[model samples]
Target chain A: MISIPIGEWFDALINWLKDTFPAFFGAVGTVIDWCISLFETVLSWPHPWVMILVFTGLAWAACGLKKYGLALFSLVGFSLIMGMGLWSHTMHTLALVLASTLLALLIGIPVGIYAGRSEMGERIVRPILDFMQTMPAFVYLIPAVMLFSLGKVPGAIATVIFAMPPCVRLTTLGLRQVPHDVLEASDAFGATPLQQLVKVQLPMALPSILAGVNQTIMLALSMVVIAAMIGAGGLGGQVLRGITQLRIDIGFEGGIAIVILAMYLDRVTHALGSRSARKQ
Target chain B: MSDDQTVIEARGLYKIFGSRVAEAREMVDAGHSRAEILKKTGATTAVVNSSFRIAKRETFVIMGLSGSGKSTLLRLLNRLIEPTYGEILIDGEDISQLGPSALREIRRRKYSMVFQNFGLLPHRDVTENVGFGLEIHNVDESTRRKKSLEAIQVVGLEGYENSPVQSLSGGMQQRVGLARALATDPEILLMDEAFSALDPLIRTQMQDELIELQSRLHKTVVFITHDLDEALKLGDRIVIMKDGIIDQIDTPEGILTNPATEYVATFVENVDRSKVLTAGSVMHRTPALATHKDGPHQAVRTMQHEDLSSLFVVNQNREYVGLVRIDDAIAESKKGGRSLDPILQRDVPTVALSTSLRDMIPLAGSTALPIPVLKEDGVLAGIVTRAALLSALSKESGET
Candidate 1:
């Protein structure tokens, strides 16, 4: 039988990449760490009640003037998290999710636009997105730890990889769905390619793009919890601790906290997506 | 926009779509059929050696059925679809040789287009959609607003300017599209099936409004349509296309009276001729006209001698006044009236010389006396009796 030693080759390649790009990887890690800490500081600066009030206001506004149910749900959900004494851990998990989602969008949107504009770009980027999405979430942690070492930074990086595919795929889909006659009209009226994108394509594609953003936030929240196993601190760490010690009480508390946070984020972003689908 | 000067011209244009354009061009030049050329060279020839010049203020229409390359030819004028091998001259500048920025300058300042489906931005209100071209030109916001408002009023959509385009009816949306094109005051207005999507009633109303607007604006217009009637109504000159080739180009009346080919003959063969032929074309000279100087005795004698039941009354200069029937003339003569004025029927129907025979059919049918055809100056030009109208209808009646 023909034997292919893929594992051995991958390890050799990783070792070489680490040796040759020590400064490069360190720089990337510093940037990511800075982003996470920045959010973490802002999140922790205000008192918990003040933060709760802010979230409540955002929920109310996102659901529009008449819809206050989401705001009430947010208020009750955050107060319960505080009552459980898991406030700081929830904040930490939030910082990671926000930073990862921000970074993913920054990179994914431009790639999505390029892929959407050209067939060759889509063909090249599609299979890679498929591979990133389908690979088990736990499989990349070993190499992540080997490369960046155990910290919030590696966890955030892994979270970024896990959550980026939807952002790209949906951006491409949104742009592709623009009517051919609309594009042709823009061209006929002397709009440049850049102008067409900004004035017409982007506006038309916004709802789909917002849907992608909602999906990314949900995926990032899930991946951050999984990142807890690699010494990343948060409610994820508390859940990991409960699992190792066979403490159902601790596990359920951390699980409930994650659920509340996920639901709040999902509702806020979902409201945003649907409201932008049409204009006044 | 100088008179008699060509504003747009195309020379030896050819558009063959596929990889081997050179081979396709060769086959097209060698007179191969489109399908044969496509099979041999994997190319479809969209326009083949087409050329024409549009004069200033001319409503030039390119007309054909679907897949006849009428739309493609319109696109070629603005270089929206580049000609495979040709030079397009606009005001003596060859657009084919101009660089991208130069070409954009021409498009931005001098050319605007209206699309078939309106091609409106659904997210924008009517005013914003109308101002789209001005915004592209980087016009000041105040000026853009003022210009767009003017265009909106021109298209008779004044109150709907602030409404979202999606909320408007299809006809209103199309008006917004037209306003968008006119907002820029471009020298050339390229309309590609602009009114084809509207239902028939709205389409006819729009066509009439366009005719009114054209008389006032006099912009050089290149219009495309598949409907023969629309072409006849709007086009100062019509170019008929078949299989990516120009079959004939002529005035509508010229084409209707004498078709250049069997294909063009078939196109005009089914037309309702009453809609095209004017009263002037069918009217005969007034055989027995009575002048006011002639008394009822003279009028009655002329009518008796001419063997007619009715006689048209005219003044000394031969300007039409009214009609005097034989019975009224006899009664006036019996009463010893001095002139035919007392007995003249002043409320009789009179038609303008330019009114189409279709619109005059009912008037002709309802009146027993001849309908006087008067020129724009009210001079008595001719008269259309029922017999003449029927004869006119019968002579030009084709398939229908």
Candidate 2:
């Protein structure tokens, strides 16, 4: 039996890439840092109550304004996070999630559309999406930290890679789910490929694509704790500190804040997705 | 190649679906059977050697049962499915080898198609779906809306313009599909079993509406159907397809009266010939006629000479007058009457040359004399005797 040195070869490849493209990685890090800070300033600079009101309004609108449940959930959930003295940390975690999920969608949707349109495109993209999803989040952090160094940018990059598969997969599913006869109708009408995609495919796929966005946001939030190990400060950092210092109370407080944030975000995004589904 | 009035001319059309299209096509051309070709080359030749010409403003129907290639043949006309080997000429230009952009241009400018399933966008309102084609052509918004509304009116879906397609009934949804196809005002309309999904009552109403629309619009239509009656009702000429080959191409009456093959004969075996065969196709040419100018003596002599009980009287201009029986003519002649009008029986039923045998049957049953079939100009073209009508009905029924 022959023993393979795949891990050794992969390590050498990573080192070579890091050494070869320092400038490229530095530019990417700068861009990532800029987006994350922008989100953080917007979220935290405002009084926490004002942000809570805004979020509650969004929930109200998403749930069609008659239902007050999601709105009330957001109001109470954010107040609890604030009362725990974890408001700023929660905002930072949210900023990281929003930025990473935004980046993931921007990259995922067009690639998904391409993959959905052609057999060859799908065949190549399917395995890449699988690898992105099934590979452990911590493994991505190593290469990301090596490339961009231990910072919020590297954590954000790792979070983006971990969270993007759902976006790509769901978008592809949406495009595929459009009926073949509808596609024939479009072709019969002399629609250009671009016209067909924008006018017919994208609108029909909206519900599924928005559902993908919800999944991406949830995955990004899950990455917060692992992201803290690489010096990205947020609720994850507080949780890490609580763990290292053996303070059960502090760890539990951080954990409660994360749960409240996840619950609120899920309701808001899920409402929007379901509303679009009804439209389709 | 095409003459002036030819809207579409298909030459040697073949569509073989499989990985080895070229091999399959060769096998098909070499006279191999479909099953044999499929087994040998892993290809199913859906449409084989289809060729025909469709004239402008003509409703040409392609009819076949399931798996008989009618739908595939319809798609090939517009190049929605590319042919493995063939030429489709639109007005004289071969569309088979045209590039993608050129084909798209032809589709936009020359052809608009409706589908069996209605193929409407569930998310869109009726107006938006109808306006889709105009928008694709970059028509200005106001114009597109106006044209869309006009098309909606054309399809009798006026009030449902702003309603979402999903909210409408299936019949109304297909109206939107029809309006969508009509919005572009293309020269040709391709309908692939467009009414098959509708209920029978709605399907009949749609067919009547289609016929009325054709009378008004004069658009060349290529329709496909599996229903024999639908093909008979809508087609000016129908091509019967079987096992990827055209069994016959003929008028509804021609298909019924003179089936080109045993397959066609079997296919049309159950059709009601009385409804399809016209009086012109069944009537007999009159042997001799008595003119109204001539007296009853001439009528009696002609009736006697032609060995007939009655003679149809005509004017000098060959206008139909009436039928004069031999007994009435002889009695009038014995009474010394000079004219046949006083004794002629005008109550005999008259029909147009184009009247269906179904209509002539009732008239034939009622009348003792031969029913006169008049031309459009009011001249007696021929006569449908009771024997002829029954024979026409029973004659083809026995053979088919």
Superposition-based RMSD of candidate 2 using all C-alpha atoms, in angstroms: 1.8
Candidate 1 structure quality by residue, lDDT tens digits, B316-395: 88898998888988999999899887888889989998799899989977877788999998889999989988876885
**The candidate that achieves the highest TM-score relative to the unseen native structure:** 2
Clash list (residue pairs), candidate 1: none
Where does the lowest 10-residue lDDT sum fall in candidate 2 chain B?
A: B1-10
Runs with alpha carbons beyond 4 Å of true place in candidate 2: B1-4
Candidate DockQ scores, in order: 0.45, 0.78
lDDT of each: 0.90, 0.90
